[model samples]
Target: MLDIDEFTPGTGSYEWHLSGDRLLWSKGLLAVYGLTQAPDRGEGFFTSVHPEDRARIRQEMAEVCAKADRFEHRFRIVRPDGRLRFVLDRGVVVRDATGAAVKLSGVETDVTDVVDASTFPAGQGAAPAARGDGRMEEADVIDALFNDAPVGIGIWDRDLRFVKINPLLAEMNGLAPEVHIGKTPKELLPEVVDIDGVTSLLQEILNSGVAKRDVEISGCTPARPSERRFWKEHFFPIRSAGRVSGLAAIVEDVTEARKAQETIDALLHELNHRSKNLVSLILAISRQTARSRPDDFLPVFQSRLESMSAAQDLLVRRSWQDIELEALVRSQLPHFAELIGARIILRGAPDVVIPASAAQSLALAFHELTTNAVKYGALSNEAGKLTIAWQVSADGTGLQIVWRERGGPAVLPPSRKGFGSTLTGAMLQSTLSGEIEADYSSEGLTWSVKFPLNP
Candidate 1:
């Protein structure tokens, strides 16, 4: 095998083990991030990446691991001094005997200077001045970055006329680079964008020689008039010979990111509403339990709480979406989990899913039925048989459930209604907006419920 220890100036190697979640970096690799040592175990090394690029990098790496062995990526990093640098990353995933990805090893190289030189190109008028060591002059460095930074870049003279703009900015503005020259923001941009605020800020920067970072602008672009776009901009004065001559800006499009954050906000709002509803439910259940069984409060209440918690766990596991009927039944009847289809019969449409709003009520009802069977019905003896089944109505919009017991001690009507019976009957009916019926006879107990399946 070829030696993989090769190292060069401005380049570093790294390896990570998926099993241990461990990352090891060569000294040169640590130096690339201005660190003298490896990060603390799993220390979020991605934090060094620019925030805007972090998610994309992680997603790309994941896709790479899933679909291919080799990968190449370029992204920006912020060093200890808070300066930005561009790096090229290339890596390979190591697979084990079972075709499982076991490790990842990679090399990274600082490519900022080379990319800058390429952006400046060979024939962009006069040659840029150079230092004694042949390094590029500061002016040329600025010119290069203004021409080809990843974000939109542009310069406007004191007269507020566009003097220069990079291709990315030109595309964002829905105009060609040459068309932007000698034009004011208002003249080139769509009226819908109404760039007066941006123009005023540019004027302020030009006059005061002050910089403004993270200034936000939102409107529709001519290229996409229907969808509103957002951008975060940085504006700073361009100075020559100790005098402010123009204003320059870099703009980053954040339209997708803005939409994503808005979605997260909406989800959080929904979660808060659901949490309040859950607390109210617990309070109501507590009050009813205390009134119904004051003497045996702890045991009764605790069992009921466990039943609700099992349903909640399923709901959470499914991200609050529909819960499968079979899964809910199994969870609510924990004592018979391993005995399904043997002594405890279960029949239902495997595809039927219970709406989240009705899941808890149904779960509680199942729990009560099972508990009662164990005490005075089929589950009380060896010869007992329990059949729990459900089916969708002919219209497919309603559900019917049955709990039947046989072959054990016969059950009789209680002297009076209890909390457990209420949970399986009236409470379930009211919660699901449906009908329930219970029959106690010499053979056994048969309880049935009908409800609309939609929430």
Candidate 2:
């Protein structure tokens, strides 16, 4: 148990200034590499990087300092004593007003302890010969792997009784290590002892003395009895006098990995559905624009399509998750972003996230409102002001949005509906599933939109 905290990674900060053509390292960083600053060797600050990793780290750093890309790299380092260690660097590029990358800075962490030494071939990380006789040192290496390795390790006897189990495997089974010492899978978790259980696998390993690889199992553990977790396991026979004795099991928790693949599958399906729907929507908008304004179809259709694209871009960036309402509005009015809080005022809960479909429809509606404001409404004059506000209902299941314009020329309600007018009126109301009110008062045009917010 004391071994759990025996080894810990170290971390430090770094900064590279492009214009100054220099690098700065924190004392903690030098400590992480077990190096002392030579007072006059700033140019050679990064010279300690292993030769094999130098070129790659330099290239990645160049990308961060030139293209302003995020940096996340793992590389090996050599200490003055010739000992090798692994480190991970995470950084971000800083840009100026002209979008020029000016600085690259972030933290670096030592991860030597986490890199399994046993995986390296002999003469590399593996012990030369343990105690000169190699017994004690070999045992220590195996002990380190058993206790400090990220995976779970367990030993089972021929009768499939738990002989020894590490803390990680104990936690996975939701049982203490001692409790599992004499218990079989059926005795501990009979429900999970079905066909996929390890009972037969261990028996086979004991019978044939050949290891069985890549066996997966799923079960509920006391740690989280309600959630069925999964593990990818392997069994290797422990030999005695060239014959099979007990079996050693290496278990890897792959619940999150499986769930991630499942999520990617669902997202792909949704993207497919969304793509087809968007294409159909674009086709409908094109026909409507061409029919309503034959001479001005191109510009009108393009403008509306851009608004839809803006919404889709937001949705795609967030993996089709709910979008920030303010972000959705600002995206549609990108040309007026600088004037957001002044000429174009926004008022609402900043954290209001809206669904993708609602985001798209609302994007179009806001675009139509903005176009009208620019051409014939408040935004057409110097004294005009546009105020947009939204609120969640008392029940928290609905939303109310109001787009009000002030100080514009006298307005009259349109006698015939144009493409923007029809969409914002009947079409938006249908998708929003609530009332849509447009007040074309002599002062200005105010559009009030209400909708149910689906979680």
Candidate 1: Cα lDDT at 88:
64
Error of 1 at 184 (Å): 4.8
Writing each residue's lDDT as its tens digit, candidate 1 over 101-175 gives 778777776655434333322322123336689777776777577667899997776777665678799898787
Q: Show the colliding residue pairs in model 1.
A: none
Clashing pairs in 2: 129-134, 130-134
Model 2: per-residue Cα lDDT over 1-455, one tens digit each:
01111122265666777788676667667677887762234347557877766666676666666765565566677889998877656666788998898877756666454344333323322223345553556546776788788999987666666655777988888876645644566777765636344677678778988888898888777778888888898889887556676788899999999999999999899878988988888998999999998998889989998999898889889878888999999998989888888899999999988777788889998999999999999999888999999999999898999999999888999989987887888988888787899999999998998889983
Shift in Å, residue 177, candidate 2: 3.4
Badly placed stretches (over 4 Å) of model 2 are 1-150, 191-197, 204-210, 236-246, 316-319, 337-343, 347-351
For model 2, how big is the CA root-mean-square deviation? 20.6
Model 2 — TM-score against the truth?
0.62
